[model samples]
Target: MLNGVSGAGEKPRVLTGDRPTGRLHLGHLVGSLRARVALQESHEVFVLVADVQGLTDHFERPGVLRRHIPEVMLDYLSVGLDPAKVTFVQQSGVPELAELTMYLLNLVTVSKLRQNPTVKTEVAQKGFGAAVPAGFFIYPVAQAADITAFGAQVVPVGEDQLPMLELTREVARRFNLLYGGEVLRAPQALLSASPRLPGLDGNAKMGKSLGNAAYLSDTQAELRRKIMGMFTDPAHLRASDPGRVEGNPVFTYLDAFDPDVARVQALKEHYRAGGLGDVVVKKHLLDTLEAELGPIRERRVGYAQDPQAVMKLLRDGTARGREVAAGTLTRVRAALF
Candidate 1:
């Protein structure tokens, strides 16, 4: 239900959201959050706290999500997203999105949803298999509502998430053609520039469930402890032995954190050639990461103490967002009627 801005513009509108699963972690920072913070200055940005979407997976844990909404907002604030620049809102707060979803659902086939690469992967990963809940199965349709509701022209996403964005575009196109009018904006994917950061345990991806994430709220002591125990070259048992860097998680962390790429390159050579131990590499990475995350951690602590202030920010954002979304919904309803 976004209003006023639909006429036409040179600057593209962008919509992105994150589920309130837990605290924002280092992976979130290096990946989407950094890009979002930067894009707010240039693009028309709408940041959504996807509590409604979170219910697709955590249907029984509504209370957990209720608790984490403020935490997610604080994380966004701590990462430098300005409230004045970006429109922040909760998905559940916008009932128009759900209304649009119901209309679009009839346009999408069950087979099509089943073929969604991201949905397929998630179903297997979550062990839902054939028992995937109806709501979870229709998440892409809901996402399409989110994108089209804002008339989002661009959606920033990781490479793996391309399928979902493509699905949104498809939904938009189909809705427009079916209704014989261009009521929705067909969104395109804006892929992230940074590579995915690996988990501290050397897992392929950092995730909260894996227990390998270094959270943004991590204390100096916690950061140090996590880095000290980080996974590195297993073959390099001795200081004199040549360590492998291809699969080394420490090298991956360096790739994400180390500002001096040349210095990290030299260290990689030293480790591979021999006489460099995993501990030495880990210590260097720890220092580099601490330097980068120090300010963010401090800001998070300050925000954590003032929960009411964070809630107020979300309330203000939701109010602004409702105005825009409600406007869009009005136009959409008029088109259908």
Candidate 2:
């Protein structure tokens, strides 16, 4: 019933977002997308398309970010995120976010940024070593700006983002203490109940860069193919061999995606005891995934047909976001002066 308006009795504000990199995959759905849909019903939600942050990694490929913005929006809508209840903002569209980031950068230090576990892990993964871009290195500050600029009370994120959210809280606290007022509100992390989904290739995380994600927009054939190729217990070479399901990516996925708890537990026991073939287990996973992704794929196709309408939605939402952020910026400036 919330129609994007805040009042004296307005619901608590929740801000969460994605960098416009590519079409969102199942990893996104379980990680944050599903949570966004649920949060909108009870909170004033702002979903940001973080183009500026995306540019930090994809600077040389601006077109990739440009192309994926709408694609990302389509994924949001396909997953049942109603624009009427959720405001979608483009990161670059609101200049105030950048202004706020510039102010916040001074509060955080280079040593502290380098010490962030999430940042350190990413730097090592990307092999940035000593060559990490200044923009990429300092994104935690930008993220803090993103959360505080909206005056968000809750931020939905995965476990990996805990450090980043903590940094944002620190920034808010430092600002309020230094500026001599409670102008910036510190946001709390709303961690996802779901664990990270493993990639088809058996990686600890499903990622687009890893090329192992089964995208939400994937066709039935695509989903089936990915499931069939999913990593299972390598030692379970034959149907007669007892399989280990603990680290097996296939069972992990089934546990994450399948809603039938009893069925999944039975399947796990069957596979552990022996006689269940990988193909049979994969087929079950494929069926479970198809049921969930089919409706989403259909919805995505429908939304993609009217690309301009999607763009307009982003424009309208970004305008609303700018108005709200501008008000926050006004208070921030007053405290600074």
Candidate 3:
């Protein structure tokens, strides 16, 4: 559908979406939203409010998801995702995508699904072990359906997500080869431009579930608390002792948010040389992050005040998305029989 309108010319379509499980955090902004905004400048971008996928894991708490949908949209808009440039879709609203996922399941094997590293890691994290739900297990097939249903050729993902996109490509390739035509478009991963930020606890990932993330909508009081408590060099017993930055979340936050590259580098050197203390570095990071988050928080407040208007935006975008997805599904069905 974007074959004619995109400024990207011959480049494949761009698809990026987030599950509406909770409010987005700084990691989400740096690792995906900022890059997504830049990509929309030259690409045909589609961002899904992936409630269906959220339900795959949070089926136990339907109300939490229902509440988070508009909150996620507020985050998207507050971060400058112009609705005119990007098509924002709701996954559950488009019935055709679920149908496509059902059809795609025939192309993916259970063994192959079991081998997915992402799924394996998630299963272990959730402590599901051998009892992982059927819906959660085959969500990769659902992801493939999301890509192929829109004929999307470019998917923006983090490194840990490449395996999921590989599953999508395999599904598209196998479907076309076995069914006799290129009915499905195999999507390629466009690795995110920003590096992944660690949690406030210095964990490998920043997650709301882990209780270690500062939300985009965090107030000054909330952010100050999180930043001051942020993990640093545990062995740096005194202000005079040298502190390392390689794994320290304070400097990592500085690297991600601090605009003054020269200042950040100098501060890192000072910290390592025992001339700087953790409190000074954290206060600097706090100011830098506040400068960036302040405006976004203000914008989110305005949007959050108008819940009805925001709901209409989601409905309109989902309607537009169905048109494109339905067209692709029609082509897929025609190719099948």
Candidate 4:
């Protein structure tokens, strides 16, 4: 159970989702998905494949997304997220989420929606400009429905997503206060502790759109090659030149991957002082990443071979999730009545 909250007997309910825009990359693994696996033992968890939300922005590429659902499920199963322990459901399957969104939207302001950092950032990132779809403009309200429909008390998200979660909480508060009913639960954010993993190209963030990500299913050779070709201290033209470690992404990978923190710390100091070469650091990163990802890749291959099994798992979980969402909708409707 989560500490420091009232209702000690009531287990913390967590709501989390992934936009199935593409195969999940390494950044997804280290950040939120790994935390979800660990939280399952203590909290009631719902993991959503937000295909509907993916369509909000990727409306033009629905066919591409339709093909990636199975691939996304494979990535989730390969990461050891047990379907039995976690409720793994598809967003489109839960009609209640959409129905609830319609009601919740009336309670929130257009200005509030425009202020959402996620909506603003995504619009700029995707160059939606004035051409933003109505659905894309109102996704935070949809997310609020996803959180409240499950009656989730906690939401796990990265720092960049905090504003979105805050909007969800505000929507819940406004609904409860206006309706004079406590039917909707205000969910709080549980920010991830893991450092944001940078991209192989040394970009500030790893993402599919940026073409800087390492997919979870990448093979050992692919992983080795990507890491070997990673951006390092550009100013350090010579191996003997004093490399800057502060912004060096190779060192950032080390900080995220290397189990031997002390050893990695010493390597960072040596690199900064003018001895460590990019090849040496890249080789070390490759070895450490392979040690962690090799097993996951093997597991992914085994699950991928029997695609039916993975689909069955997702289908079964989605059925169970529908039952829960339906029950919650009943209560919400009765309260509104």
Judging by lDDT against the true structure, name the best candidate. Answer: 2
- Judged by whole-model lDDT over C-alpha atoms, candidate 3 comes out at 0.88
- lDDT against the true structure, per candidate, is 0.86, 0.90, 0.88, 0.85
Model 3 agreement with the true structure over 1-337: per-residue lDDT tens digits: 3422233445457888999999999999999999988988878788999999999889999898999998999999999898888889999999999999988999888999998999999999989988899999999999999888877878999899999999999888898888877678888889986788999999988997999899998999999999999889999878899889899989888888888899999999998999798889889999999998999999988888988998888899899889888987887788786
Task: Give RMSD (Å) of candidate 3 vs. truth.
Answer: 1.8
lDDT of 3 at 10: 54
lDDT of 1: 0.86
Residue-level lDDT tens digits of model 2 in 206-266: 8888899998888787888888988988899999899999999988888888999999999
User: What's the TM-score of each model vs. the native?
Assistant: 0.96, 0.97, 0.96, 0.95
Regarding TM-score, does 2 or 3 come out ahead?
Answer: 2
In candidate 2 the C-alpha lDDT for residue 60 amounts to 93
**True lDDT of residue 171, candidate 3:** 86
Show the lowest summed lDDT stretch of 10 residues, model 2: 1-10
Q: Total backbone clashes of model 2?
A: 0
User: How displaced is residue 26 in candidate 2, in Å?
Assistant: 0.8
* Per-residue error (Å), model 2, residue 105: 1.0
